[model samples]
Target: MRFPFTALPLLALAACTTGPDYRGPETARPATPGAQFARASGDTGPQAPAAAAWWTALNDPVLDTLETRALAANPGVAAAEARMRQARASLRSERANALPSTNASALYVHATVPGLDLNDSGDSDQSGGGSESLNFYNLGFDASWEADLWGGKRRGVEAARAQLDAAQADVADAQVSLTAEIAQAYVHLRDRQQRIALARDALARQREMLRLTEQRHAQGTASALDVERQRHLAEQADAALPPLAAERDGYLNALATLAGEAPGALDGMLAAPSKAIVPLPPAQVAVGDPAELLKRRPDVRAAERRFAAATAKIGVAEAARFPSISFMGLIGIGGTSPGDLVDFDKLAAIAMPRLSWSFLDFGRNAARVGQAEGARDEAAAHYRQAVLDALRDGEDALSRFGNGRLSVASAARSKASADRTAALTRQRFEAGAATRIQLLDAERQSLSAAQSLSQATAAMTADYIALQKALGLGWR
Candidate 1:
């Protein structure tokens, strides 16, 4: 067979790609790379964040277990994982598009005709009606392949791979959010439980004061106003208990749902306070730098991947503006008799090479390319926004955590002062120097201070969880 000289240039240009290549997005960067976060205070250190499971740093066994369960069983995480699998399958399909596809077929036909003779000789001809039967059999293999002359199929595969990467990043993002939510709920639950316990203790003291006031009034020493006031204070304390209990239950149910269980499934395990106080985060948090934050944040990574995918799709669209080359082939063997089906002499083969171009679509392909470019621009903007958002999140979490630490410290000072005053009043009351009402009021102030401290600590822990999530430290 002689080679076709006219096909030389087409073969040479087959390796050429039509559209621009991806070199990573220019906008996917923090405003100040390698700079320490502006909102980080003395409480945070400029060190690379710890390993993926940052929750274990809190040193709470129950929290560690909850994180594990949420990551393993949460429906949101599972859904993200399923999407990743789907992207992978799509990538595989796109890769297969670059190769040829083949199919095999078989056919059989039988017919009978009247007034037709099955055998006829020139020496003998009959006018009488006769029936003739016929049978046909065929087997064939057909194959076709579209050549990637302008790299459209290759770009499609590239886009698919990028989409798979984005999907994987999405799964990681889900994990980050899940772990943070579980940790925050656990903190809130413990905080509410502690507050309830404190309120109950204060209520008992208030009731005792109320009883003492009533006795004093009956003895003609305390006024009726004093007794009523004591009762009102006791009632207020009692009323506070139900709301705290309700909030505690709400957090418990949230945690259970986060672990992929029913609302009350974790009640037995978490209803009671595990510790005397909510767990506090470490003193010095490792926040790394802005550059590292951008790299670690899954949302940023996912957005960048999507941008890359969009860029590849531009190439796919641009390739459509050019001609496409394809080839088809068929081979078969068949005969009238069953033995003839295997006969090489009855074999047939055909090869067809085709070129198709949509140059006269009145700028439809150009519009498609323009649309792809617009999409690419949108994805780039989204990626840039994602980067900025991640930076802001990290900074905001750091700021909240720093301020939370200050609030906790102030609350601690207030609690210490209240405790000292209460102790002095108790001493004075035992020595018969201070009134009973004075001592009870002192104790109430102390309890209020304790409640404030608990709330501040829980808020600080929540801020810590947010910081870790912003750092993308909850997934491998």
Candidate 2:
């Protein structure tokens, strides 16, 4: 009764937490034109908001298949998932520490003695008393519970739970990065294929010009210098093909690896050039503001979770300054005969309560508290940095995506103008109203314009993917 009364005060204090409680910081988007964006808004596309699987917007079946494969099998994503599982397991273990534990055991012993008291056992023989051994048996359970009077165990659970959240966020972050990289590689692949096709068309035109120049020079209608320059120009245009083909191959191999396949596995699918230019998103991208980004970005969430973990650790450290209480109990039965253990009347039991304090550690405990405080400060700084970084990435992605649309538009206009010019020059040359040089120059301009258009279109696609990555899409 006295023990129960004395423990009442400790139970009441168990609800007290010693360290500073955590409060989430306020970090809203900066107020400006378009609110969260610094350069422009709606970089994620005009028609629809960016979906979790943003790659679907490309409308390329091959790209869709590849994105699905990469997300499912990418090594980075798998590793992050494994880490999340590990963190969850750790949390379970930490939570277990706050509960009572019990263990069961059985022991049997026999010993020989030169002069033993055999009269204590009825089974001992009088003639064999000098060499007889007494048999003893014990079977019982022991239990101990460390009362969470100072909340140390609870704080450990809190920290572990925060770490688990961080790990889950890490998995989402990995998915975002992996999917974006695959999309970028796929876009570059198609771009090279289209460039190669454009260059091949230009080579054919250049060859035709070379043949016409040679024919005119033989009739003294064109100079030998013109024939030589045309031949050199044709060879130079042809020279650009191999590097683009090689780049295409590289992207194919990279995509295969990202999809967890061997190199060259996707070659059969991508070796042939695409029949048309890869598609690009329409004019307006639907991007969220920076304020929304803080909530969506996995890395930002991970940073905040780590900060929470650090805060909990501070409480765990502070708890060491107080006393610890534990209740221990044991029950067993032992005798010279094993049958005696089955009799409850012969059982022995003990219940002991203990209280301990590290008051003599002097400044050792205080130093631990200081270490925890420093860790909390460091984590808070990281959380701030994460917010700033997310904002910067969002702003940069929007700028590039918005500007990419402009570049593509300009390239399209240039290609259109060059096409009109080339067609007019060919018609004039056929009517004998323009020189062969003018027609060849016009053809060259058209080809160059076409290449620029292809590259710009590819850039737009790449920029959109980067925006999705910055917004932490594709991991849902």
Candidate 3:
């Protein structure tokens, strides 16, 4: 059935409510020319996503499995999903009023009458009594729906829909964050494992050098001070090993926890050796566009929806101050017995329209409207801030990732040069061509350079993870 034309004006007015409209804030695009990474070929303003499973580029089966498990069982992910479910339920509740509601009922009544005789007095005896029972049955349907004359219901529905959208965006944000975190932890764990190996190897080399120095000293070819120095170096290297091992264990435990597994459960999976390599896409990452990012990023989308919800709330608060019109109806049949109750002659129906007003709650209603407006303003500010933050994050990540790559390469070269120096120094010492002091210095240099490389590699991998996160994109 069609609504009366007179009701159409109310809906049109509701569609024109004075509330803030959400639109993304202004943003700057990435530099077209000077960006560190080259844009992908056939790229428009923004690059198309490079690869869906970016982690696969690392070629690690264990990491892939861990990522999948984390997505499924991570506490944060579960919380996000629950929030989405709640939003969905709330949306359903809000829409329920858009349609009419119906109800049914039944009842019974009984009574007795007592009487005394008067004429029997002459006859010297008399008595009388009467009893009756009545049963009523009512089977009927009654429905009433608000005209939504001012679009209040529609606006409320709009707000609920926006909230649902925001909840979904939150889930996406949580997923993206989880993936980045897992990758970062995995990289750190691998770096620590490599460091542990380096420490052990350094300790072995130090012991061998100390043994040679002691042998030379025994033959009176080396000074006691030189032998003592070698022993001290070996002890220092040995001391470093335990800490590296501890760190490696800590990272492993962290990864296990993040993957929703008990600590040490992942030990077997990660028990195998691994290396920390900064997994940059074999090609440049395609960051679509700065404007596109505002739309694509879940946080940004969530913020926008929040702003819309806040705007709608203002209408809800405003609608409260006006008369709330409702239609009510009742229909039923009743008689002394069940068969008579169904008689068409006893059936009846009644309908009425009711209007309610909160005559004494002006202060409370005004305060609610004011509160909604304030909330809308706050949401607007937050939305703008979120947009700015996204741009800054992307730019910072790209800058760091670019520089970090160079730093890793330099550190690796330094480590290799130090290794060569240490090896030659040892050979020379063995042939009596180099002093013990020189050989000790070469070993220290090699160890220091190796440590620097390990640190740089870790930093590089971390920056890559940060870049992906900032881009608001990652493996699903």
Name the top lDDT candidate: 1
Give the TM-score of each candidate: 0.93, 0.91, 0.83
lDDT of 2 by residue, 132-202 (tens): 66678998999999888878888899999999999999999998898899999989998998898889988
Q: Residue-wise lDDT of candidate 1 within 310-404, one digit each (tens)? A: 99999999999998889999999887667767888899999999999999999999999999999999999999889888888988888888888
Off by over 4 Å in 2: 1-5, 28-34, 41-51, 111-134, 271-274, 435-441
Score candidate 3 by lDDT: 0.75
Sort all candidates by TM-score, best to worst.
Answer: 1, 2, 3
In model 2, residue pairs whose N, Cα or C atoms come closer than 3 Å (at least 3 residues apart or on different chains), thus clashing, are 42-285, 44-285, 44-286, 45-284, 45-285, 45-286, 46-284, 46-285
Tell how far residue 9 is off in model 3, in angstroms: 6.4
Clash counts for the predictions, in order: 0, 8, 1
Better of 1 and 3 by TM-score: 1
The deviation in Å at residue 54 for candidate 1 is 0.6
Model 1, position 145, has a per-residue lDDT of 96
lDDT of each: 0.89, 0.85, 0.75
Judging by TM-score against the true structure, name the best candidate: 1
